[model samples]
Structure formats: structure tokens, C-alpha cells
Target: MIKGFILIFLLGASATYCIAQHNKAKSAAIIVTGKVLSQADSNLVKELFFDGLHEKIVNNFQRASTNFNKVLEIDPANDAAMYELANIYHTQNQEADAERLIRMAVTVQPENNWYWLLLADIYKQTQNMAQLVPVFDELIRLSPANEDNYFDKANALLMQNKVNEATAVYNSIEKLYGSSEDLSNARQRILIQQGKPGKAAAELEKLVISNPSDLGNYLSLSEIYAKSGKRDQAIAVLQKAALADPANALVRLSLADHYRALNKPDDAFIELKVAFADPNLNIDDKVRIILSFFPQFADYKARAYADELASITAKTHPDDPKAFSVYGDVLYQEQKYSEAKEEYKKALVLNDQVYQIWEQVLRIDITESKFKDAITDGEAALAIFPNQAPLYLFSSIAYAQSGNHEKAIAYLKNAADLETENKDVISQIFSGMGDSYNALKRYSESDQAYEKALAADPDNSYTLNNYAYYLSLRGENLEKAAKMSKRSIELDPGNSSSEDTYAWILFRLKKYADALIWIEKAMISGKVVNAVQLEHYGDILFFLGNKEQALLQWTKARQAGSASEKLNQKINEKKYIE
Candidate 1:
């Protein structure tokens, strides 16, 4: 409410405002060492005072203080000098000196609101609410039309925990100038802060009754009633608000909350659906309500209700990207991948600025094995967010699957650098890099990448299985591969891929009997048999001296759709190759 002085000119302005533009202080040289200069004797008082004004205007407070002090010594009852010196002292944090000087200024010029206002500030600094009341009272008497005086007085009263006095001040505002939001809100807040909810409720109720068109007053009143356990009264207030504003989204939202509190889901959902469908409700607010109030998608009934609301939100706000984004989230949670992608794409069309939405689109593309779509979306995302690690990782996966192993390795390397701290995530990136190198037939680079992956996260089951399998395929480091493969199986128990890698490593190690046990476990434990697992089983069988069974297994491998290059020759020769 007060503009604390900063510049030299503003201090002059304050002096000008207080004195109603008194004549500029003239400069004069006066030596006071000989005797104390009385007010009448020091005919150069105005000149010395103006010199002080000039010094203060230049922001030289020390010089200004000296000039004003001399003026007071000469003119003992100079109110203007007292006010100026008090302001300087207050700015220097000399509150006691400032208080005394300002108090004397107010006593000399009791009709000046500016002096009283400064006095009030000094009282505020000293935390003397008792003196502040009389100061503001005098300010109000001096300028009765200044509403700020009333607010200042009320706030000071509230600081003293004199809530009733504060309420009276607000009431006085209503009497002087009809009931207003500023007055009602201030009074109601103080009453509520004082633990007088009943008084707060009554004050709001009066506003609601006096101005039925003000939906905010009704909502505030309803909240108070609801918090006080007057559920029926709360609902009644919202119901009346609904009557006034039939299509009001906030009213519907309030009604929905009240119905939910009463355990009426059917009624609550009806109100919520209308509220969500209302375009007047800001899209962000709708998203906030759905996220904060609605149950997560894990709850079946709640998911259904939330899905319906999300659909309504999208329909009402077709152009708003957030509405479609949230609806896409609901679909994504329900595992409707294709539909979710379409909704997310719609959001991207409306606005491509949000990285999360683009990430969601790529995530769905990856999940559905849409490598082409994933590549395109990942490229687009990277164009906008070039440093996003997840985008790099996803793009690498898409490129890898599309047989662009060199590009995949590049993206993986960059992603590894970008995502450094999270060991699990970095391990995934390094493991991907290893796979890409292996695909490019750069086995040494592949092995180094795998080692880096393991260094980051020792328990990375995917890395363990893949690295061990790659080593087993090359017939090098079979002993270490066997250990890693076995640990991979232990870390992620019942995963057929890990089990198959372990069994194949055992076969390479010439532990054919142990290999036979694990191959059969992979076959029986898994829902579907892949060609590698079947071919590995054949190799183990032939090595264990079961040539006939090996041929039969090799034929099964050919039909299983991922048979190795040597599988056909092994079946034709009725012997395991490699």
C-alpha cells in the first residue's frame, strides 16, 4: 500500500506531497559554532532547509540528516524537518529514533495523514500494534474516504489477533460503500483464521443471499459447509448455484464432489460427465481434476468413468491439445495401443511443442512393432528435442530393427553419453550398442560394449543373456559365458531366452548332459518355442549321441521360423553342425 522511497526525486515528491508544494529550500552558509541559533535569529532557516532538501534529493542521507537536524535545532517546532529526519532515520534502520521524531511530527501536524502514515510504518516496524491503532484512526479521520486506511487498520488489528475489530472495520467498509468482494473476503478470512468457521460461513452466506448471481460466493459458502460436516447444506448451496448457472462447469464440478462425498457415484458421475464436457472449464483444470480426483486406471469401475469423462473432454475441446493428450493417456493405460497412438497423433497435430506427448506416440509405435512409424516419430521428436535421451534410444531401436546397425550404434553411443547417471538406463543403452555392433559383425567392439554394460549394472539380465549368447555363438570364452548365462537365468527366472542361452553355453562347454536338462526346461517352461532354442536343443541332443532325435529337432527348428544358417545342413546330414 505504501511506496517506500528509493530515488532522491521520490523523497522530494514525498516532501512536496506532505507540504503541498512548499517553496524550494534556498542554500545559505551558516556557521553555528559560536552560539545556538534560535528560530528567529537564524533568518537563513529556509535556505538551510532547502540545502537539506537538495542533499536528500541527491540521496546523500547523511548530509540530509545533518541539514534537517540543524533546522530542528534552530526551529525547535519544525514539523517538516522532523518528518524528513524521521524518514532518513527509519531508512537507516534507526527505528527508535525514527519513532520519536515521527511521533513529534504527528503531534505538531496532527491533521497530516502523511505524517500519521509514516508514524504507522514506524509502529509497524517496532511491532507496536497498540500505538498503530490510534495512528490509523487519525489517518482515517484525516482522510475518511481513503479505503486503504481502513484496510491498514484492519490488517494491524488482525496482526493483534483482534479478529472482531478487523471484522468491524470490514463491516464499516460495507456500511460506507456497499458490500464488496474485497471486504467480505477479508472479513471471512480473518473470522476463519480465528477458528470461527460459523462466523465465516455466516458472512459468506450473507454475500451469497445478497448477490445470488455471484457463483464464487456460493462455492465458497458450500466449501465451508462441506468442511464443517454439513453435507446436506453444502449440496443445497451447490444445487441453488446449479439453478442459477445451469451450464456452469464449476457448479457441476462442485455438485459432483458433493455427490461423491455423499457416496452417490451414479449422481456424482452424472455431474462429473457434464462438468468434463463443459468447454467453459479450462482444459488444464479438467486434466488436473481427472488426475488428482479420479481414481487411477487400476480401479476397473473408476477407469470406465474416467475414460468416459476423458472422451467427453476431448469432444468438447477438439482444438485443445491437452484434452486429446489426456484421452490418449487413458487409452494407453487400457492397453489400446493403436487407438492410443491415433489420439496422441491428433494431439501432436494440434501442438508439437510438448515432448511427453511425442514420447508417448513413439512408445506406442515401438510397442506395436511399427518400426517405420517409430523411426519417423523419433526423428520428428529429435528435431524438436535433440538432446532427449529416450528419443535417441527409441530411434536406435527402430533403426536397429530396420537393419541400419551403424546408425543404431551411433544413436546408442550418443544416448549413453546423454543418459549417464541412471545405471539401469545407461546399461540398457550400452547393451543396445553391443547388439548393434554384433549385428555389424564388429565382434571386438561388441564385446567391449557388453563389458561396459555389465560395468554399469552387474545384474542386467538382458545384457547377461545377450552377451553370454554372443560369446557362445563365437565358441570363445565358453566358461565365462556359461557363468553369465546361468546368472542371467537366476536373475530373471523362467525366461526361456536366458535359459536357452545358459543351455547353449553349457553345450559349447561340452557339458551335454547338463545342457539337455536346461534345453528341455526352456521347451516346457515357455509358451512358444523359437527356432534358436529348438536348434540349440538339436545340437545338444546330437552331441549327447542322439543323432535321430537331433534330426527331428532340426526339422522342428526349420518350422519354428528363426532357424540358424547351419540348421538346414544339420537336418540334411542328420548331424549337428557347429
Candidate 2:
């Protein structure tokens, strides 16, 4: 093996000597070698070289060492070959061999920053920070004017937990480069990490002020302020940035978010209005923001914006139904249902293929308990998009609400069959079927449907709570119902409906004290608390011999919307104190 190696090296050395002696002859030799290298045949010299490299790379260290040595014999000063040989030694856990080869490569190419960088990388990989520092220092010295060298050196210092060194290097780069955004950003990050947020904010603010066209500076300043927990200052900065560039839609949107965070809904809406008018913002996003704030603004502003949206839709997207659909959404959020319905109809007329508008109309009908109308709209939507599972789900719900359980189950089953991989969708469909069966007093069928729902989504809080409540109402499966109720509460402690179900299940089992605790928890969980839950709480208190508190709770339930005969009977039977 050693004799073969010596022969190969001698052949290449002889070629070099011949080239030095006869330049014209060397040029001809180079052309011949180029021709051989350019050939498509695998038998070519370059192809063999690449094949050997590939064979080395595919094997472990033993094969790689031999192949890389052979490559070095063919081309004595190949830095890439030396680097690969070093990598092979390193991967084989031969640290001494790797370091020796890498150091020799760097010494041979003293001007090559890449060789220095590779040495630094090897030191970093081995966690030799002391060795890495000197090597990187040499690299930066050789490439002093290159920004990447400075940046990489700074990053390496930062990784070594040398914050002051990193900061100083970043500052040096920034001073020399004159406000390069990357160096400026690096300085700010280091300052913030060093707990000098004030200095960071000041630098960023100046950067933003000087470079007003660079909105990223303003955004970074806002982030820095927000990270420092100075939200009011952040918002104020964004507001100024918006005023500085009113025509910038992104700045206006950012300003609107700031206003929204400050609870200044009217101010946010005004900014959003200007942003939406720019034609730069995505129409869908603009419309969504407009609708979201429409409900919060005064009625006149909502009406005016709704009119503006309609005008924009008519002028810009005359052929598109999505604009009209957005107009409908804004109107609907403002409780202008009749106008919203007309807009939806107009959208549908413009493009009957848009199933979402049909679904939107169906949702409105469902909200108003217009089950027949909901069913009609849902069916119309399904006609356009037969495989749309949400449309099928809505159709089943509307049919069930209208007392057609058979058709409801059929639609729900169709949805379930189509979305077998989507567990949440299947669970929801089966839950809808269970609700329909329960409404029709088919207890056995309801039980089966509920079981199907649980099987699909074992931890679904909504399905667990509703199905458990139904079980309690039927006076069977009390223990299973109690367990399910507890599970629902554990999954979503803040869900008022789930809490109510748990409390009611406890009441059914005559655990009155435990029932009252959970009932009160449900009542307090919501700001606009459910009336039915309050009445249930009152009933639990009444059973616990707290007549006065029970009456008070029952009265509050009446105010919220429970006008049941049972509640009225309790109020009449219980005497009040003057």
C-alpha cells in the first residue's frame, strides 16, 4: 500500500516538474486533461475522482481516509480534499488526526479565511472555546473589512456567554459600516440581553426616526418596548409611526392593533378604515377587521362603513362575490339582519357557485330559529359543494331542528362517512345525530349516537357534557354520567355549560352540597352568565335549606331570561323579607 502511494505521488510531482520546465507543453497537457474531465463516460478521470469521493462519503472513516489520501496524491493542494479527510477523522473520533490535517490545510493556505473558519468550526464542535477565540480572531484579522467575518465572530462570542465582547464587536461593525440594519439590530439584541433595554430603545427610536422609510425599524422598536413591558410607550411609538407614513397600509394596521390593545375601538376603526381604503391591504383581511370593529363602534359608524364596503365591492370587485359576502358579514355583525340577507342574496346572484355565502345565510336563519329557511339555504349550499362537510353538518342540524330526524341522521351519516380521518368532524356529526335522537325521544338511538361520538373523540368536552346531561335526564347511567361530567369539567374548567352539566349530574345523584359548589362556579365563570344555570343553582340551594339565597338566585335567573313555570312556583311559594 505504501509503495503504491509513493508511486502515485511521484507521478503527480513529475508532472508538476515537467509543467514548470515547458509552459506550452503544460498548456497542451491541461487541454487534454480538460477534455478527459469533460467526457460524459463514467470511465473518465474526473468521473472516477467523483466516484471515489462518493464511495468514501458513503462508507465509515476507514474507506474515507484511504480515498481522501489518494485524492491528495492526484492534487496535492486540494483544500476541499483535505477538509473531507479532516471530517472523516473527526467523525471517527480521531481528534488528533483531524486537528493535524485541518491545521496543515490552514497553514498551507494562510490567506484563506474559509480554512480558518473551518478550523474555528472544529474547535466549536469540540467545545474548545479558548482555541475557537484565537482562530476566529485570526480569521477576522485576515478579512477585517468583510461584514460576515465580524458578524460571525460576534455570534461566536455571544454563544460563549461573552456578552461584553459580543457587544463591543457589534458596536465596532456598526461604527465602521455606518448604520447597517443587521449590525444595528445585533447591537440592540445584545443591549437588551445585557438588561440595557433603555439604551436599546433609544438606539432603535433614533434608527426609526432617521430611516422613516424603513418600517422594520419602527416594528423592531415597538417589539423592544413591548418586551420591556412598556406597552403604552410601544403603542405611542406605533401611533407616531402611523402618522409619519399615513399612506403605508401596514403602518396603519399596526397602529390599529395598538389602538385595539389600548381599548380605543373607535380610534382603531378609523385607522382600519384608512388602511382598507389604500387598496394595499388584503381585501379579505381588511373586510374582516372592518366587521370585527363594526360591532364595537357606534351604530352610525357601522352603517357608514357598511356603505363604504358595499361601494368598494361594487367598484373594485364587481365580478367577485366575496366582496358582497364581506358586506353581508359587516351588516350581520351590526344586527342589520334584513339588509344582511339581501346582501347575501345579491352575492349568491352574482356567483351561485359561492357556497360560503349560502352557508352564511343559513347560519343567520339558524340563529333566528327559522329551521325551514336554514334547511333550504343549507341544501342550496350543498348543491354547489356536495362534498362540503360543514354544509352537510348544517343541513342535518336544520333538518333535526325542523323535526325530520330521519333526514337529519342521513345527512350526518353522510358527513361522517366522508370525513373518517377527521375525528373532530366525525365527533361533531355524531353529537348532532345524538341531539336529534334525544329531541325525538328515541333514548336507545340517542345512546348509540352519543357512544359513536365518544368513540371518535374520547375527550371531547362538549360531547361529554351534553351526553352526560342527557343520561342524567333519562334517569339511567348515573355513575357513567357523573364520571363523564367530571371529565368534561377537568378538560374545560371555564366552560359554563360543562360546569352546569357536572353540577346537574351531581344534583341528580342527590349530592346537593357538591352540586351547589359546581353550580355557583358555573354562574361566576361567565360575565353574561347563563340563566338556566342560575335556576339550577337556586334549585340546589333550595334543597340545601338555603331558602333566601335560593329565591335571590332564582330571581336573577328570571332577569337573565328563565321564565319557566317551576322557577315562578318557587318564587311564589318562598316568602321574601321586607
Candidate 3:
């Protein structure tokens, strides 16, 4: 009965008569017969339909619904009005109302293909897969020659895991229009999902046999076999593909993948080398394969293989910047920083627009203490990516390292203004500002910068050590300096420089005995005690009344190549000058 009632209430019956015939109708009629009679105007229904469509287009759903409801009121079998109202409800996510109205619409105008498509779309949107199958069946009945409708029905069946029914739909497609690559692939996928790899492989084999000259079909079959864990079968199929087209890079790449999966890395590299040598294989694909080996770069053998592949890539695609980029990445991963920088520079010359390569160039320059290059490259990168905070930060670091404190502060302040969300970058900016201010002998500004740095990152050891050492040097805030210097040592226990700072702070606090103890500890902890540290130890000894030993220590400080004017005065006077 559901299928037979193609056009329910087809007669031009009066509204009262129709309503009286169905007492079980869910809702009251929106339009009374009196209104229809008054508006008994020409093309009244057509006017209302266009009005509804205009309202819907302008997003006036209430007016649109009113117009559509009036259309249905005058003519209860107005499928177009029902469809428009259903689309409105669907847009509002009222799927239940959408489904009900669309069902009525499709049933009222059985031959309207648009109405049936809308019904199918509503079912699909709601994921009402149980009901979806019947809608597609109705569509196929309405549009018998449309091949796409059958495919939709097959996909709907597949969504419900009804593999057998889905297979029947695919077979129907083949029967209607002879076999195609699309149909074969769809059937192969279904069979594979149904745990019928053998059948899936056979399905693809038919394509190869039907068109033996198509190398892609052979690769497709080999891929299916590989996915099914048939290593030997995959290799044999790819070998056949290679023999069919010996110059095909795709075949060589596939063979490499199979060999790599089988743990024959040597065989994989050989195949990759052959593939890389083929100019027909584009550089983008070669770069993708090279990047795919990134996860395995930690292994020495894998790194070696990647190195060899990069060499082949360079030889094959020497003019491409991406080739040099890949070569740089391999060298970067191996910690060959200098070599990596050269490769990155080569890539930059070919293409300077790639931000990642520019970043690499700057990173290696910074890491290898080539600050001049970092500043030059980072400045160029900034012209392209002006708002990039890290570029400003690296430029700041480069300027700071080169003893240009004013330039460093300018770059750090610029970076601080641009960086909002990243607290680490902000903290580093303020810390760099503190160091630059201290270098310029701006004590008040230096103090403020250190405070801001600590507020952002309270445990920044570098900032703590520098701030504390500067305070101790000025002979101010001795107690607070002692605390911060001690914290820095605690944060980095094995850092001899931090230990020396703490000892110097203790010396400034006039705790001579404690200062001597800490300075001795500094000397022992340090790998190679510097001249400043030796001088500090001499000062501590002199404070403890060991004048003779202090002179010997001061002489040693001079020999250690860090003798200041004060230290020379102290040794010549043979006493604590202060």
C-alpha cells in the first residue's frame, strides 16, 4: 500500500470534504475555503509559490512558511510548496518535520525527480539509513536510466553494512552500463571490506586483463595484494608492471614501499635510487617520499639511506630548491649543523620565499655562534614575515651576542610588543632587555627589566644569575642578591658560573668565612676556573686575613689572564686595597 499510493488525494476535492474524509489528519487546515474563494484570483497558487520562494531566499522563514502553508491550504497536493517548507525545516535542523513534509511531497507528486531527491537528502542528513534505502529505490524507479542513482543506492546499502545488497546494486550498475574503472574500484572496496581479499584481487585482475597496456591497473592490483599482507604477490605484480613499463617511476616507488615493508631496506633504497633518477618523477613527489622517511631518521642505517637518497635527489633535480631543502633536512637531523647551513643557503638562493628554510638558516647560524649571519638572514626574513615574533627574538639574540646592546634592546622590545600569548617568548624578551640594560650601565632600567622577566617566568636562572651578579657588583641589595644567586645555583647545581655568582654575592654581604667556603666550592666545581673566579677567591682569602696566600692567588689570577686594574693594585700593595 505504501508503494501503490503514488498520488494520494489527487482529485480537486473541496477543503471541507477532504478534511471531513480524514478525521485522523494531524492538524487543522491552514486555509479556509472562504479565503480561497475570496482570493479566487487567476494563478493564485503560482503567485503564492513564487512569494514563498522569494521569502525563503531572503531568509524570512516565517513569511515563507506562511506563503507555503497557504499554497498547501488552497491545493493540498502542492508538492513544490511542501518541498520548500521541508527545506526550511531542514535548514533549521528540524529533521523530523522535514522528513514528514518531504514524504508527503514525494507521495503527492511521484514523478517529480527533484521531490524524490529532496526526500533522499533529508533521510541522508538524519542518518535514517533504514529509511534511506527505500528512498533511493524510489529514485531509481523514477529515473531508471540515471547511473548515479544506482551508485547512491549501493553506497546507502554499504553504510548499513549490507554488503550483499550493496554488491547486488553494483552488479545492477554493471548490467545497465558495461564495467568501468569506477565500478571495479567500488566493488573491490566492498569485497575487501567483506573480508574477501581474494575476490577483490580477482576483481582488479579483470581490469588488468581487459586492458593489459594500462600500467596503473597493474599497480592497483599490486596495492590491493600488499594491503592484504601478500608480500610476494605484491612484489610479483609490481615486477610484472615494471617489465611492462621499465621507465615508470611509480612502479619503482611502489616496489620500494613493498620492499621497505618487508624489512629489506637495501632493496628499498635500490628501488628508490632508480626512481629518483627518473626525470618523469616530479620533484614534489620525490620530496614527499624523502619527508616520509623523517620518522626513521633516528636510525643510523635509515639516516644513511636518506643521505644517499638526498644525493640522488640533488643529482636528479639540481635546479629545484626543494631538493636542496631535503638535503638540508637530512644534514640537520644528523647534527651536521655547518653542512646543513650551506644547503639551506643554497635553497634560499633558489627560492627565498619559503619561511621554513629561512628559519633553518637562522637557527643554524644562531646555534653555531654565527651571529652576523643570523642577523643578516633574520632581517631578510623579517622583511617577508614582518609580524613573526621569533625572527625579532633571534635578531635580538644575535645583536646581544655581538655586543650591540642598544640594537638588542630595540629588537627585544619589538618582539615583546608582537608576542602576546607565548609567555616563554615574552619572558625571554624581558630577560634579554635586562642583560642589554646592564651592559649599557642603566641600573634602574636593568632592575625593572629583571623584575618583569621574573614576573613572567619566576625561575629563569639566566636572568636570576645576571641580575644578582649585577646587584652584587654595584654593592647594593646584598641580601636579596645572596638569595637570588643561591636560587640560581640551586636551579643549576652543576653550573660553575652560577656557583661563582653566589660566592661573589656572599662576599659582598661581608660574610667572609661563608664567602671563602663558597668560593672554594666554586673552584672545585668549575671545570676550568677563570681569572675572575681566581680573583674572587683571592679577595675572600684576603678578607679572612690570609694576606700572603691572597697575593699568591692574585698572582695566579694574573697568570689566568683576567687580572683587572684593582687586582694589580692589590698584588702590588700586597694588601686588601678595599
Give the better candidate number (1 or 3) by TM-score.
3
**Per-model TM values vs. the true structure:** 0.76, 0.47, 0.77
Error of 2 at 481 (Å): 21
Clashes of each: 1, 0, 0
RMSD of each: 8.6, 12.7, 6.4
Clashing pairs in 2: none
Runs of candidate 3 exceeding 4 Å displacement: 1-76, 84-94, 180-183, 246-253, 273-297, 306-330, 338-361, 384-386, 507-531, 537-563, 567-578
lDDT of each: 0.83, 0.75, 0.84
- Model 3, residue 402: displacement in angstroms? 3.7
Task: For model 3, state the Cα shift of residue 541 in Å.
Answer: 5.9
Model 2 Cα lDDT, one tens digit per residue, 287-405: 66556645545767656756675556545665667777788877786787877887889889988887667778877887778888888888778878889887888888888887898
Candidate 2 worst ten-residue window by lDDT: 4-13
The lDDT, on a scale of 0 to 1, for candidate 2 is 0.75
- In candidate 3, the residue pairs with backbone N, CA or C atoms under 3 Å apart (3 or more residues apart, or in different chains) clash, namely none
Candidate 3 similarity to native, TM-score: 0.77
